[model samples]
Target: MVKFGYTILYVEDVEKSIEFYENAFGFARKFVSPENDYGELNTGGTTLSFASKNLGVQNLEDGFIESTLEDKPFAIELAFVTDDVGDLVQKATSLGAVLVAEPKKKPWGQVVSYVRDLDGFLIEICTPVEM
Candidate 1:
């Protein structure tokens, strides 16, 4: 059986991506390069890494690749769970994240919202309602 441990994302600016994740999603940096070409972020139980395309070859299987004849940006969606969806939404919006959805109670007993990161990756912040 394969267990998922972490996810990696490719960005135009690793430093800016790191800062956005840290401020918007409350992730802390595990390590960062002086050149800002790459960095790792710790999200409680998992780690997310950011890399710049100009730095070197990226492992394509990580799922952040976008193919275009010209250099076009590509991004993926990542979900985060929180106890207070409203607060997280407010924090993310304040941090310059584009709000895609507002906090709303869902039928699955979850209050959720969606936001786009600096790199245009979608993120879902949610709180599971008690059944």
Candidate 2:
């Protein structure tokens, strides 16, 4: 059987990235490596992990592309489901996140907003879609 365990984002500083998510979204730290080059957060269901770019270079002989302040964010994005999209969006912006879009009701009845994290990663904050 196959199951998604986590999503890893390659960052310049693992600890810094971990701290950013913790403060911006209230996610608790699960573990941070002794070397401070890798860390994980307890994001409820699937884990959110961070690995330093140095670690990525070591793991893959060929280096990987990294998000930068100057570069436009990648086409992909990470989304978090939240009931209060407006409040979360405001808080996220106050914590150094770039506001990409304000909350809006979709035709499907979901309120959604977008923000760019400290590292320029696109994040979608939205109300949960009813099943």
Candidate 3:
């Protein structure tokens, strides 16, 4: 059997990326490599991980397009569900996250907003979707 495990974002600074998530979203740090080139966050069921761009380059023979705040965000996004969408969005922005959209109530009864992390990755902050 196979299962989804974690998502790793290649960042310029592993430590700072992990720190940002910890400060902005309150995820606890799980571990960091001795070289500080990689780290993981204890994000419940699926871990959220970060690796330095150098590490990513070492792993992938072909270089990849790095995310940057000056560019448009990638198509995919990491969504965090919270009871208070507005507050979390505000907190994230205060911690250097770029606000992409303000919280709005969806037709499905979910309040959702968007932000770009320090790495310029799109993040969706929202209330849990009712099934």
Candidate 4:
């Protein structure tokens, strides 16, 4: 059996990125490398991790596009399900997250919104979809 474990974002500053998630989402920090090139957060069952761009470059033979606030967000986004969509959006925005959309209720009865993290990574803040 296999399970999805962690998602690692390539960032300019690993430690700073870790701190941003901690402040915005209330996840506790797990570890940071002495070199400050990598870090992880205790985000429940699946870990959220960050690694420096330098590390990314070393890992991938071909180059990769780096995330920046000035550019449009990439195709993928990290989603966080919450009970209070409005409150979480406000909290994230308060910590410098750029609000992409206001919370809106879907036909399926879920409230959803979007925001971009400090490095321009898109994040979806939403209420869980009920089955």
Evaluated with lDDT, which candidate comes out highest?
A: 3
Instruction: For candidate 4, give the lDDT of residue 6.
Output: 89
User: After aligning candidate 1 to the native by TM-score, how far in Å is the CA of 82 from where it should be?
Assistant: 1.0
* Clash pairs, model 4 backbone: none
- Candidate 4, residue 115: the lDDT equals 98
* Per-residue lDDT of model 2, residues 1-131, tens digit only: 98899999988889888998999899999999999999999998899999888898899997778897678889999999988999989888998899888899999999999998888889999999976
Per-residue CA lDDT of model 4 for 23-79, tens digit only, reads: 999999999999999999998899999999999999997989999989999999999
The Cα error of candidate 3 at residue 29, in Å, is 0.4
Candidate 3 weakest ten by summed lDDT: 11-20
At residue 127, what lDDT does model 2 achieve?
97
How does candidate 4 score on lDDT?
A: 0.94
Task: Tell me the lDDT of candidate 1.
Answer: 0.77
In model 2, where is the ten-residue run with the lowest total lDDT? 62-71
CA RMSD of all predictions: 4.2, 1.1, 0.6, 1.0
Count the clashes in each prediction.
0, 0, 0, 0
Candidate 2: misplaced stretches above 4 Å?
none
Q: Which digits, one per residue and each the tens of the lDDT, describe model 1 over residues 1-131?
A: 97677777767888988998898877888999988888999986778988886653544544445432243324456889889888888888898777888888888888888877766677889885577
Order the numbered candidates by TM-score, best leading: 3, 4, 2, 1
TM-score of 2: 0.94
Worst 10 residues of 1 by lDDT: 66-75
Q: What TM-score does candidate 3 reach?
A: 0.98
Tens-digit per-residue lDDT, 70-122, candidate 3: 99998999999999999999999999999999999999999999999999999
